[model samples]
Target: MKYSREELEEAKRQIDSTLHKLRETIKTFEAKEEKARYKSQITLAKRRVKAFEIANYFIEEAMEK
Candidate 1:
């Protein structure tokens, strides 16, 4: 699917926001006293963070081209 420059820019902004929130969530989960209880949730958030980072990289590349 071909995305326009404006659309790609908006998507990048949204992904950036989501990535920041996900990182904060991971930090919060790790800081909890019973960190083991949220282990699965933390892992899920970490995976999402990685995915978003990859997506952002693609978006930037698209914009460059």
Candidate 2:
């Protein structure tokens, strides 16, 4: 997918914010169910962050060409 620099920056910011929230939530919870939910959220957030990073790299490469 094609992404502009502005969009990539926005995505990066949003992803970072989401990851932060997920990590904090994970840290706050101690119950099994709550911890499971937070763990899943954290895993999902990490995957999203990585995906966006790859997409940003593609955008960078496209910018160079």
Candidate 3:
């Protein structure tokens, strides 16, 4: 399947937003002694990183097209 340039741009924006939120959550967790929340935040951060990679890939593909 092929994505339009606009679609790719939107995906990148969404990924960026998600990553920013995850980072903020991690910072908040760091200020507390909630082990479960901290662990969940780490997981969320990892997922955001993966989403970023996917967004980057789509953006590159769009550029090539």
**Separate clash counts for every candidate:** 0, 0, 0
In model 3, the runs with Cα more than 4 Å from the true position are 34-37
lDDT of 1 by residue, 6-60 (tens): 9999999999999999999999999999999999999999999999999999999
lDDT of 1: 0.97
lDDT by residue for model 2 (3-59), tens? 776776677667567656755654555445556656766666567667756766765
- Cα lDDT of candidate 2 equals 0.64
lDDT of 3 by residue, 1-65 (tens): 77777887787788778778777776777778776757876777768777777777868777677
What order do candidates take by TM-score, descending?
1, 3, 2
Question: Of the pair 1 and 3, which is ahead by TM-score?
Answer: 1
Q: How does each model score on TM-score?
A: 0.97, 0.50, 0.64
TM-score of 2: 0.50
What RMSD does each model have against the real structure? 0.5, 4.4, 2.5
lDDT for model 3, please.
0.75
Task: Report how far residue 1 has shifted in candidate 3, in Å.
Answer: 1.5
Query: What is the Å distance of residue 5 in model 1 from its true position?
Result: 0.7
Worst 10 residues of 3 by lDDT: 34-43
| Number of colliding residue pairs in model 3 | 0
